[model samples]
Target: MTIDEQQASVAVIGLGKIGLTLAAVFATNGYYIFGADKNKEVVASINQGKSHINNEPGLDQLVSDAVENNQMRATSDNVEAVAHSSIIVVIVPVLVDTANQIDYQMIDAVVEDIAKGIKKGSLVIFETTLPPGDTKNRFGKRIEERSGLRLGTDFYLAYSPERVYSNRIIEDLEKYPKVVGGINEKSLLLASTFYKQALNCQLIEVSSIETAEFSKVAECVYRDVNIALANELAQFADQTGVNISEVIVASNSQPYSHIHSPGIGVGGHCIPIYPYFFINKGLNQGLTPLAREVNDGMAAYAISQVKKEVGSLANRNVLILGLSYRENVKEPTKSTTLLLIDQLLNMNANVFVNDPLFSDREIHAFGVTPLSLQDKSISKIDIIILQAYHDDYKNLNFKDFTNCKLLFDGRNQLKQEDIKKHGITYQSIGQQSEKGEW
Candidate 1:
């Protein structure tokens, strides 16, 4: 089918953050979109022109516009969505199990559903992150077997992993160059033509589907390793009385040096999780597993620092600010803040959590009492851990934390001299305390 003919309809499977955003993007670009999800509530909400995801910049108005213009519709049945469109884009998540193994069950189940209704000449593109060769080997074979059709002849198969983060989905989709690869030359040309016409972005066609799959995994692994290096350096700096942040800034004056900051721990869906997709496939050259180890231990390290400063946790009321993994995002997927809370509870500390993005009931569900920043109880807290660097907490006056004895800046958000001027013992990830005595 030609580009104009294929633009008539597009089906997006998995109506989560990425899936729903892509559906809205396609709809706004003039294609009628059919969005399918297993959640009945999400389907109903989308059909009613409401967005189920949170904290995305402009998704609500985009979805409303698409639904009002008759450019988008949603359903719970995957087969129905597939039958209504010629181009199918899959954006389901592939997660890692507790044993640090890649879990293929979710993607496998999605392919089975798509196979039941996929028509001839339809293009099936995968936007989920995968191990090196799973796209061409596992997914392609599953579609061919279930549909009783051959790839590249009766249907097309391609891989183009989603590279956008949670908060900047729409902007990144339009700004970053898209990497696309297909099982064959015809599939490549067809997929390229579709994305170029549908989105305002440049497409980089690679040699094969495996190359594209590896590219996404490689990018995430590089970040994991870089951050791990910074985390390890922070440990060394703490022991030697050196400021790791200053060292990093001075070293990065060289053109080739690009260093990431050290945090309480690595969180979010992409960096902490994507490395295992390749490591479990026997690509562990030792650096990947070690990086995961260092990043995972950072949460416990932050808790220990709190204990050191406060001297005891038996009767102290500790307030943890920010529950989400990162600033400004409402998603807590794989957030290290949860781990810190668990550790604090186990130490018998009375923990009170607060985040402007999450409701009090949401924080309470995690087995901790939620406190508002304006509550009178804030002045009575013994310690404050700034787990997330939200913009709302950036310019907070020192007067608000006067009653707090110790403040642990987990994200390095507060200045040391300013915090010290308030008479609170300040500790951060990589910087040494100015007071010398905690």
Candidate 2:
């Protein structure tokens, strides 16, 4: 099929952030899109023009526009989604197993389903981020053999890695450049044509599929390493009684260098996991001691800082602010704040959690009762840890926190003056509060 014909039907497997956003973008650009998910309720909600996630504006409108115009819909059956389209995109989660090894179960299952129903001359593009050589080593041959169609001629395959955040999925859809590569020239051309038509941004082509896969991993590895470095520096400055935030901001004044701010630890899915993907692959090929050591040590270091702040761990009422991975969104995947909570509980600290964006149901399942800051219930808490720097918490009065002697600013959320006036002993990332007895 040619480019125009290729634009006729597009199937997106796994209706998560990447998949759903791609579906909405393609459908709005005049392609008929089909989405599939294992969750029955999510599929039902999409089919009825609704969204299961929040803080993403205009998703409902986009879903409604697509369904009303007969451009998009959702289904629980993967076979139906595959059979209905000439271009199929697989985008499922690639999580770590119990032993911290890469688990290919979700992607393997989707490939099996697609292999059964995909047509000859069809295009299969993978948007899921995996370890390097995953397409060439794992899924590529398995898919071709199962379908009984010769790749490069009878069928096609490509890799187009996704680059967008959870909260800004829509805006980034039109902003970031899209990268495309294929098993062969034909596959690359076909996939490129499809993306160029829908996306209103730049498109770059690479030499091979593996190059594209490595590039995707490279993008994330850079972030993970830098964040780990920032966290390390933050810890060092804290020990030396120096403020790292001010240091970074001052250094950023130079036009050439721009450093990322330090945080409690790196969170979210891609940044934390992608570095391990490369490091593990490196270890299999040879030794990868440095990469493994720096990234793996980050979470534990953040937890140690929390321990330092609380002074006495036993029977302390600790209020944790921010349950999500980052501020302003409700996605909690791979949240370092949650890791801190788990470590604190192991040390026998009484924990109370709160996040403005997350629901009570989500918090209760974390084995803690959600506390309302509005009710002045913070009076009884012995320690307050600012895990997320949400906008809602920025201008909050430190006087309300006067009852709490210890304030641990995980994201550097507390101001210096407030810390001084309240006479509270405070700790923040890359920052120093006047040391006082708690």
TM agreement with the true structure for every prediction: 0.95, 0.93
Provide backbone clash counts, one per model: 0, 2
**Local distance difference test, each candidate:** 0.88, 0.79
**Which lDDT tens digits does candidate 2 get at residues 196-248?**
88676689899989988989888876776666677778878977888788788
| Regions of model 1 farther than 4 Å from truth | 398-402, 434-438
